[model samples]
Target chain A: MAGHKIDGTAIAKSIRERIHAQIKEAQKLNPRYKPCLKIVQIGERPDSSTYVRMKLKAAEEAGILCELVHLPSSITESELLLQIQNLNNDHSVHGILVQLPVPNHISEHTVTSAVAEEKDVDGFGTMNIGELAKRSGKPLFVPCTPKGVMVLLKESGVDLRGKNAVVLGRSDIVGSPVSYLLKNADATVTVCHSHTQNLSDFVRRADVVVAAIGKPGFVKGEWLKEGAVVIDVGTNYIPDTSKKSGQRLVGDVDFDSAIEVASQITPVPGGVGPMTVAMLLQNVVDATTAYFDKQKARHVVPLPLKQLSPVPSDIAISRCQHPKLITQAAGETGIAAHELVPFGRVSN
Target chain B: MAGHKIDGTAIAKSIRERIHAQIKEAQKLNPRYKPCLKIVQIGERPDSSTYVRMKLKAAEEAGILCELVHLPSSITESELLLQIQNLNNDHSVHGILVQLPVPNHISEHTVTSAVAEEKDVDGFGTMNIGELAKRSGKPLFVPCTPKGVMVLLKESGVDLRGKNAVVLGRSDIVGSPVSYLLKNADATVTVCHSHTQNLSDFVRRADVVVAAIGKPGFVKGEWLKEGAVVIDVGTNYIPDTSKKSGQRLVGDVDFDSAIEVASQITPVPGGVGPMTVAMLLQNVVDATTAYFDKQKARHVVPLPLKQLSPVPSDIAISRCQHPKLITQAAGETGIAAHELVPFGRVSN
Candidate 1:
């Protein structure tokens, strides 16, 4: 069977268009308000620069403000943290993303955690990752690559429910979060990494396969179940004597042979790469919308539940039993304590 | 071949003896110092009382102090939280655990999040969960049941690396954290829940199976692969006319048939249940050791690397290039700027 090549560039183009429309609508409502994303880059690695440039360019197309704070490689951990803190406090900055491979001197945790949870657009913060892993409340942001993979799957009209999805990686950024997202979508996900024994056996049973282990051509076509949908997230540079640069990009899956067996497949450079940038732009728009909504809600009193956890069904039912605690909790929301009466408990 | 019945009680006893030895050594050095675990229980469910009694008795036998704070069911969430905050501030309190099912009036997240991370013996806090998910660095405390499962595996002499592990369930306390721990130990981990399609198919291929779904006998004996090691985390109550109580506890797995195929299997009631309390006591001792060690370290100047991230190989090599930042990072650890000389850079 010949596979349908999923066009990530076209899908990303459509997503950016939606983001542009949303930004236009928000700015029309508030003349002074503009959605802004700040990219914090430490040291000038060629790869990092290229990725940052793509993000900035996409932001411009989406009509979102893009600001880059390029710090020297010599910057210390505290110094980079100070920069992140400055971005965190800036009300104009709706989304804050620190480009990966930040100078060797800076701890990734220190840099990421410094970002305000509300403004952590990259979704690299530990609490953000924790939120993603959690089965309940909505995550503030899903990391770009994983979010992109989800979007691609949706656009391809893949019904994830009851699907046997195998993910070949356990990385925090892509594999871990993506698997959680798939699980959240009701897909039966298996995460196989370097430690997996008989990895091919797991791959062969999958209805959907995601290769993101960063090893070029690690997944063979023989491992694919006939008509399985494949999403290759790995981006590795393999030596190519045919090219003047002496190297070419490849994915974790062997695309040439995979196309023959799979019903749907994504190519190396064109598949997941563009979708990642699109998702980043989408996050910026989302963060902007949330910021404006929060600002408007500030003028009016927020609901007591809004101030509490994201999913308050459990607490909402229990709130009826504690009249005094309910009044106090409601009082914080600027509501009249006496007016908020006990709704009576309803047990699940 | 008949399977070996795993002895969780014996393993836990051996672990408790080690904890006793450590506590005795610590007390000999400082007579006033004693490891203490304070459990805050709201409402007296018979099950909760039984579990708490077992934990308290075990702690006493291990020469550890265990205090139970029994609060009324009508107590407000804030009131319980205030009590927890008080314990958090108390230097004498080594570990603070709010017993599960803390009346419907309280949000578990609100109560658990209130426990100080350093003194969070249950390890349910978001940051603690984050540390557990993190690829590097040690988590201060792992949730007891998951930690217990890891101990059981190690004690059984099962090499986790390259094992095909299927975790049945995705609850925060057991399936989720345990999967992360298994992955960290280098086992290929697949987490299956109710949403999983053809659940039996995945279970039948697993080398190591962990059943955490709370349904009794949900995993049939026929579903297990031959010679698989089974860890049943489920303790479901089912009606049994033969029993005087009218109900008996059973695990998620059908032990009768599973034993015929599995190489090793843990029985219901005595398996995971005892190990959970054992790990809790172990955490108390560990927390106490950490507190004393931290106090001792404060008296002596800390090394620069100790103050930094666990892996700083990248930074160590780059230290020569950034002398000013190196001195500043080193300065905070009590080293003079001029005294700390860079040895030269070694590029990776």
Candidate 2:
């Protein structure tokens, strides 16, 4: 039997629609409201430029205003930081994303941290990374790729709880955060890297496998368990003389063989890549909503939600049960009540 | 053949001896040099009190100064925070540890983050946690239990490279950090928690198993691979009529059966418990050294190492290989030359 193809384009389109609807509703609540994202790119490479264009197009499609700031390679780190600081203070800019691999002279950490947590749409800030690691409260922003992988798993109807999931990589942007997210979603996650001995042994036992090792076809079909759900995040370029470009993209897993072993699998080129851009737009919408929510709570801005969609009744019931406890706690801390969103119920 | 028992007491004693030697050397360099730790405790739970006393005793025996600041259970969060801020400013306090489970009225995040990163001996600060998660630089402080586990593994001569290491917990302080640590040390790590469906299957395939799940005997011996190394971090008290106190401490692993299959194992109470305190003392020494190193670089303090132990020859060789590039970069960043410690020779 052929494995089910986990279509990223379809899922990404659905997410974009949801974001579009949300943004439309949010705008109805306030006419001046428009989700916005600022992309700060320094000395862009071909790959970086392609990604930025894709993201900007996706954001516009999702009812988000996108601005791209291009800086020269000779720009000093301080100058780049100043630009980010300006974007951070500009309340009109709801999300800020600094494309990776800025000039070597610039410290990535210094630039990444300069984006305010409210506008850190990439979710690379130390505090956001810390929050993700801690698995406490709602993470301000889940890194796009990992967050997209999660949406795929969720939409696929894969039950992660109690599943033995193996993540093949430990990259800061993808593998590590994805493992943490899977664990938080109730999957038992094993992270295998180059140093992992007998990597096939772990793969053979996993119910779900995510390959982000960057090597082309590093994970073999025989190593995967039959009926495993596979999410391949690797996008590697390899020689393909048959093609006009003399090169093609492949994932860490041998898709042709893995499809035979995996009950479900995501295809390269169309998988994981599109979901990342969709999540970026979603983050902009989220950041915009949060900004307005905080302002409304402070009584500094009027936000009447009469024309917007009402919250689902089931959620309304559950939230009503808590009454004033959450608000009271937030008040005591001098934080606006709307910002203290609680995670499910407190565990004993 | 009986499995070798890892003795925690002996290891702790040896560590204390090294600490004593280091303190003597530090004093020789600067007579007024003193490693000091300030532990703030609130509402003295019996368990918390016991741990605080043990840490204090260990610190005292290691030739370090210790102080306990007790606050009433009813203390407001702000008041507790104020106390922490005061400790943060005390130049003489090299390390600060706020015991966990401070009154519910106070947010743990508030108390934990209140301690400055330099003085956060518990290693719970977001920046420190982020550093540990990224495995980029030397963490300011490794959480006591996880750090102890690393030391135990090293002392046992376990080659972590390419090892199948399964961490049987996902607690922030232990399992998560330990998994990151093991990954950094070149081990393929699987983190299992309450949500894991087939925990036994994962454990049985491990070369090294770290059980920190807190459940008494949650890990069965039959689940361990033969010759696997086991490090149990659980300290659970279960009712036992045979004991005079009507209860006995146990670990997450069934040690009696584990010893039969494992090549090495640590016993409950006699194992991980002592190492936590030992590592705490080690962190204090580290914090103290960094404090003085900074002051000495500022020319605000006189610290000469004429009578102190010379740097280890192997480390010295590694340090000399970096031909001043790191120091130059650090200098450009406004850091003093003396404070620019290099980590081997990897540079642009």
Candidate 3:
């Protein structure tokens, strides 16, 4: 590591450790504090199965309980939804993930929408996605892979505010959601995809470049700005005669060229790949804990204030002020308002 | 004017004319057929009220009825939401629009979310936005200005597919959502914003550039590619002694130099400006038509089949299609029956 190589694996390990500590503490308060994850897999694809298997193993290593719910290829649409309804009602199954690319007879939208928003660990459900979209206006659980990417950036100590960031790919699963998260973090974000012209032009100007394209080695180092932070989200596998399994996994960035110019770079396997599943485990643990919180969080959200009728225009809630008050005081003292607010509280 | 100058005002007039024809046809079918729009204003912003009046006049000119629901500046949050709820439930009202930048007191999110998805002609609701985020998904109403940008591009006969496109803003109300629309329409899309480093480097390579930076003459023509299609979304007013109002509207691009180099460009005031309100009126009509198709459309959407338990391990959804029919076809073919099926599309 010439300058800085953001070790996603190490960062993920620290997060898992923190979560494990929280679990241990929670158990003391209540022995029933178990982090449980349930993955709903439809007709199987080898790649998906391998990914699901990796998640299960990772969850177990994190000391979280895992359950795999397998579905038949010939399963009917209503039956699949019924299973989701049951999972939604199950207090023990904290987080639920329905693997993608369902049968032609099924609708992915219907399947995704079926997962209760609280249990949507994959974060593809309509309500969950909608909540994420509106998160800047009000905070909500962000999607996992993007959440993991945010962790890697923050762990590396890069300032996100006002940073120009470009993301490759626009799939709802990664690109668009990541851009939204980056924007929410106060970073100026740009999303470029296949329809995008001259991809290198955008990449060369990025302070942070997130390459989520499924294509291997698509983001060349020359395409990057010198000393830029790089997060490689693609997990493309290519056949390799040298490997025992006749295959090897690589990322979207060209690692050799990237390491020379990057201020911080993540390696393919040890970087984003491990972090994705780790975040899922994190989501599962959070969902299980929240199940006990029940309607308390909802109740705590406060009623949406009295109707707009007969209300004075100047008296509307406007900026909720708890955070603004500190900023206002700092402003009078000539200190940056951000300096007054608690820093490093938003650990991913 | 060089070849790049597009008559946006003329195009908008044509689109508006087409909508008038549609409204007249609907009137023939039902005497009660009316494309009625409601404008809910919470504050007394001069510019916002001017915009509201423009929309109302446009609706009337296009053969649609309109009403203004004036709320005092001191309106309460719940009251505003209740008004939106009433508009949502009223079959007489085809579309609902709430003038933005409401008094600091009211929550934009709360107000936007309160509008029923069907009545949200502005297309700012969370559910509609979520729908906009998915593959093969279409929002009930695409936001006006961005949709207007598309109308201009299509009218100019620009082939969006495989073309390089860059947007110079990331506002959710414009840049971000519009980028998705451009990409979905098949142009490769890259969004460059304030966080971007060397913004010109990206602009220089664009086949198409949409300037929405809200800064007058912010994008220099030299940064533009030769023969580029320019769509300026910026509505900046610069103080000018030559103007009676002490100000004149200008777009983000330096139009003087841009017209000389570009194949097509939209002028500031008459270009995209007129198209915005036109799209709004169009959305009102669409909102009415959609209400008639809601139940029918939702019923056509099938549930997810993958969520069911005991999933098959062998066949993948994409790799194997119409399993039964393919299996039968293969069995008839007599060459290792039941395994091969063409993918992409399959009937239920």
Candidate 4:
């Protein structure tokens, strides 16, 4: 039986529509409210330009104000960092992203780290990645590609809880973060890389397979378990004499063979690729909402401090101050009562 | 047939001896060179005091200047933070650890994070834990329990490369970090926790099993694959009227049954307990050595900066400067030739 194909393009379109509606609602509340995204491209690399253009178009469609700042190849690392700093300081810009494969002179690590944690929509910075890796960490934004993969998994109606998930890469951008997401979702995730031995044995037992190794057809269909769900994150281009570009995009899975055995699969080019831009748009919207929420919260009146003679100890002062119930406080901050998990009476 | 005992107590002793000899050598060079550890204990919990006492004794035995600061339970978080700041600023203290189980009024997260990263020998802070989680991160110190577990595995001669390792529990201290360590060592790791369904299924295929779920005898021998290496990090206590304390320590795995099925295993009480204190002393020594190394490096002559007439761009200025070969630079920093992995000409 042929497997069902996960329609990422259609799913991304629906998500973009939701974002557009959300942006419209926000604008209705305050005409000045606009989610803004700034993309920094260091060089004129054709691939980088294409990706940036795609992001710009998607953001525009989603009612996000997307701006591209194209810097020359001769720009210095310090100059690039200065540009990022200016964007970081701008209150209008909610999301800032530095396109990858920056000039050799500019250390990618330094450039990515330069993005403010609040505005790091790409989620490549140490703080974001670190939070994603942590079990109890709350990352402001997850990297787009991994976030997109998770969306596909969710849309496909696959219950990750207690399932066996085998991630086929360990890259910081895709494999590592995705593994953490799966584990957090309660999947028994096993990360397999080049160093992994008997890779087929792992694939054969996996209930869900996410291949991001970037190799063309690295995972064979015969190696997959029957009725397994496959999410292919690879975007490798192999030579295709019939194609006008002389190459065709293929995923890490042997698609034709995998389609026959897998219960659900995501096709190359139209799968994980489209969802990335959609997720980026979503992250910008989320950041913009948070910014406004913080602004609203800033208006809250501060409690009058009652000073005691000789100044009591810090704990004594705190204990004397009556605090709002945690549930009430959470509600005031837009958190639903169901969303609050009380650990103890400290907040009571 | 019974499996061989891991003998963690003996291994830890040998490690302590190594640390002692190294400290003696450092002191011989300069009598002022002494590793110092400061452990802050809040409240008078019997278990906390016992653990702190054990650490103090072990650190002293390993030639480290160990100091315990006992604070009242009523002390506020700010006061405790102030004390930690003092230790952080103290040049004589190489390692600073805050004993766990602080009063409910004090946020453990805040207290742990307040410890300076360089002096956070406990490795519970966000920076250290985040670094530990990253793929290419260089954490200053791994948490003592997880570090000890790795040392046990190494001493037992188990090569983790491409091995199937199952880690039980997902606690940040032991389970999470140990899984990262195992994955970094090239093991295909599956982390199972309370929500995990059919946990036995994951364990039954493991080549190496690390149980830290804190439930006594949670993992049975039948759940483990024959000849698997087991490292139990649990220290659960159950009623034993026959003993004076009316309790006995047991591991997450049923020791008696596990020994019959496993190739090597760490017993309860004498196993992981001693190693924790040993690793703590080792971290202090390591920090002390790094401190002195930094001091020695500070004495190096600085390169004279050349100011050009036209005021060149940052990239141009950097490009004009000649950099020492990475091998030579690494050597100067005490990194051996074999330890350096050349990525590209950027370092040349």
Candidate 5:
């Protein structure tokens, strides 16, 4: 039986459309309101350039202001850090992302740590990852790929609670964070890595399998539990002379065989890729909304009062003061007019 | 078949003796070299007092300066925070520990985080635990209980590499950090909690099991794989009419039943309990040694030299300068004479 294919492209598109509409709606109330993302790219790596371009185009399509700050390969580590600090201090930029695979001369750890935690859209900093691992931690923003994987799982209607989840690979970016997310969702999570023995024995019993080992077709269909949900995060290139590029993108799971057993599965190229960009855009929107909400909440005005000459009884004092309407109070607290619900009139 | 009892009490005693000897050796060179621990205990909860006394006795026995600052239960959170800050700023206090169960009014999170990360001997702070969770993170100090568990595992001759290990808890204290440690050591780890289904199936295939769910005898011996190693961290008090106190301490695993099937097991009263105080004293010593090492490292003196009229070739310049003996150089670099091994005569 052919398993149901998870249409990641459609899901990602719908999410992007929702984000675009939300941004447009926010702009309608305040024309100046706009979510902004700044990407810091170093060197002229072809792959890095391609990813940056994809992000730029996606951000623009989602009504976000995206800017690329490309620097020369010869830039010193201190100079790179200064650039990130400037972006961090800029109130206009809601999200800051430092493209990975930085020049060998520059330390990736230092560069990633330089991004302010609040504006760290990539969420690769120690603070964010550390919080994600904590049992009751509240991270400001989860990493894009892991966050996207969670969305795909939810969209597929998989109830993670009490389910056995086996995560292959333990990369800080994908495997570790996703396992933490699965555990946080109440799934019994087993993290299998390069050193894991009897790896198939683990996958064979898992209710859900997330493969991110970066090896093409590393996970076989026979290893998966029948009707299991498979989300492959690997993006490996294998030789395919029939293709124009002479190579084709594949995931850790062999799709042909997995589709025969999995109840739901995501394809390689279009699966996790598009969702990453969508989640990045969503994080920017959320940060911008939070910024504006804080600004509006600060607009609360103190009510003026007439001082009485003599102190009155508590009942008399309460009767003397005039109370504002519930709607007026709601407005003062930054609640939108459309959000207010009136439950009967206040009695005198 | 009966399993070997992991005598944590004997292991802890040996470790404390080594620490005591090390401190005495250090004092031989510098009489003032002393590791100090300041434990801030809120209220007078009998259990808390008992634990504090155990820690104090263990620390003093290990040649550490232990001090207890007993605060009233009525103290506000801010006041408690102020006390922690004072301890944090005190260079003389190498380790600062705040006893748990502060008070109903005080926030435990706030109190735990208030202790400086450097002086956090208990290792309950977010920064320390966060570092522990990272792939290559070098935490200043790991939490005592988890650290003790690792020591017990090591003492039992359990090689974690490529092993299947099941952790039966997901707490910020024990289960979580130990799982991370095991994973870091290349063990395939599955973390099971209250929401886990088929928990016995997970434990049945494990090479090692660590139970810290606080439930007495929750893990059955039948669930254990033959010859599996068990590290029970539970300390539960059960009514025992045969005991003088009318109660007895038990672990998450039924020791009598577990021993019959397991290769090794830790008994509740003498197991993880004693190791906790031993690890705390070790952390205090480690912190004090680090403090002095940093001070000693900064004692390097600049060598003065005469300027040459004309720049010489590298070979010519090397022949003109006087060279100090290797021992002299080692001394300047804070290496003790006993630590140095002079290989030959340094080629004259």
Candidate 6:
């Protein structure tokens, strides 16, 4: 509120534009490049249907292919798994995302894990989490919400290095992963949860406060530092008699007073909400590019407990200096040291 | 010097005593339950060898089994992989650590990943990192350096919640992970590294500073706020005419000046140093416990990307009380429906 409002909707549109351009360029280079996503829906929930419909609309608008898989609520867990396996092995699919809150009858982990790491564009793959922890990526997709938040920050001229950041919440999707993403960017971050003894103490010390707590109007301006950056990740809604829908979408922050104190803030419905879809589109474009390149995206791979898997047995490589070199370290002979790159990678 | 000196040696000794007591109790319960760690050393890097010896001595003193597998510098990476695999499959090896700087010819990831997550008591395994990131490890084994720092802060009576923490470094081993750990503990953390612009401005704002840059005396006291807690993590040695060895160990912080303004400080040799070994020993103990518990340690399983592994599927049970005797109206069954009561599992 203190700073100018960051227009996340417009920004998301711009991001989608960039991704669209990237996909267009890829298509020029490879005729086979088609950004295709397979979305698996598990039940007849109305909310889930609307969300999928919006995604399909966005995909079409972006000139990407969207395939939907519908399953009954009574479907056996094993049967759903078989479907995921078939998709995982399918070469045509670049991204696979099974809708969340899967009927509450199926184990979420089993369903989430069924999507191969490379195809998990939702950034929920175990290996991707591993890589993100290492500041590395294979599935290469950062989650939609966090990625959108990062884009918003960078585009809005918020420098993360050495900034004291307080994230309110620890949900896997928004809070926890965002903390990791921020740290990877060199920001000092603290995550406050229900068990945190006092929340205001952490908030006042923060240069950036990320409110991901699900409670409506849970954070107030008094808890914020003057000129702080505020990102509201909450989408909690409260019932309103004045509205036809009988509800209003609100964020976790007390926007009225907070806007007066904070240097920059994100609005709720028009803010992070729009960016998630944009970020999802970005992932699709990335998968499309990786597909055409005949390459697999990188993701974190968790090894089994106490079981070491031997790496690919061998690879060939060479390193040396030409005869013109004149140092003990660099032999004068054109024939120099032949060495296999360690970690099977060449360091420049 | 301003800050009250934090006695790392004393704290480390106390921690070691606790671990020894734990080992004694465990042995009483299960006579054959001896903690064991296999450390693989490649080449004669003095630093690596010293660390290995220190760890080995500490493990032995704790009444734990310890083995050192020293490999020649010329050994091919494949051969090292085979060695790690052999150890991974060995039940006797509760924890496995391949010493760092494992030759330029070898990949550190290869070696670290090769040690099954269960045996990665050093907390460098991909799964270990993922588990730490997820904040799901019960009795989680944090990477040693960071864990040591956390222990030091805890022992010194510093409350991390709401504290403004500035960590100076982004190394895989200490800076980055420590930032994550501190953030998890509820401190508003800021991480600074080479890419960070306006470095001093960031440091001056912190309530606490963790100086981990390898540079000797890079951070001055004036860079810190008055009453700020300082945790020096540097182990750098610089020329010193007064020392018999012609060099002295200096921390990243200008200790003389920082001590004056800081409320608490950790010394060079005594600070953060002993704690690393203590944490490693603790991890070994944890591995032993986990092995006997017969549960898949998530810390040992690295999710390849952001996605988790497929969970064991859940079956559809009608929500009506008529369908589930486990619940009335099947409302909130409250019981973890998927909870497995394995052969050896205990339930309340």
Candidate with best DockQ: 1
lDDT of 1 by residue, A1-348 (tens): 689999888888888898888778878888866889999888889989989999899899888889899988977675576577667756778999999866666777777878888888888887777767766635789999999999899999899988999999988788888888898888888889888878899999999999999999988888999999999999999999999999999999999999989999999888999999988888888898887676555233222332455556876756744233343355455443223443432111
lDDT of 6 by residue, A1-348 (tens): 256788999998887788778778877887778889989998889878988998888888887898899998987676677688667757677888898878777877667756777678888765566677775433377888999899889988998987878888877678888987887777766667876656787798788989998999888989999999999998987999999999899999998888899999998888888898888888878776655543433332222222235633323111121111122122222212221111211111
Task: TM-score for candidate 3, please give it.
Answer: 0.81
Evaluate model 6: give its TM-score: 0.72
- Cα lDDT of model 4 overall? 0.86
Score candidate 6 by DockQ.
0.15
Worst 10 residues of 4 chain B by lDDT: B339-348
In order, what fnat does every candidate score?
Answer: 0.41, 0.43, 0.37, 0.32, 0.47, 0.20
lDDT of 5 by residue, A58-119 (tens): 99999999999999998877667767867876778889999988888988877887788878
With a 3 Å backbone cut-off (N, CA, C), the pairs that clash in candidate 1 are none
- Tell me the tens digit of each residue's lDDT in model 6 across B1-348: 446999998888888899999999988988878888888999999888888999989888888899999999988776677677668766767888888878898888777877777678777766567656665433245788888999889988998887777888877788878877777777766667776667787788787788888999899888888898889999998999999989888889888988899899998988889889988888889888977665332222211222225633343222211121221112132222123122221111
True contacts kept of 4: 0.32
**Per-residue C-alpha lDDT of model 3 across residues B1-348, encoded as one tens digit per residue:** 464678888988998999999989987986767878999998789989989999989999999889999999987786676577667757678899998978999888888878877788888887777777665565788889889999999989998987878888877688877777787887767667777667787788788899898999988878888899999999888999998999999999999989878899999989999999999989998987665444234333233444335665555643433233332343344422113333421111
Per-residue lDDT of model 2, residues B91-197, tens digit only: 78999999997788889877787788889989988767777877453568889999999999999889999998999888888998898899999899889888877
Tally clashes: model 2: 0
| Candidate-wise lDDT, in order | 0.83, 0.83, 0.78, 0.86, 0.87, 0.76
lDDT per residue as tens, model 3, A79-143: 78778877886767778888887888999888887887778878887656665654334323567
What TM-score do all the candidates reach, one by one?
0.84, 0.83, 0.81, 0.83, 0.83, 0.72
Q: Which segments of model 5 are wrong by more than 4 Å?
A: A29-32, A293-348, B28-32, B295-348
- lDDT tens readout by residue for model 2, A226-279: 999999999999999999999999989899888988899999988898899998
DockQ, candidate no. 2: 0.21
Better of 1 and 3 by DockQ: 1
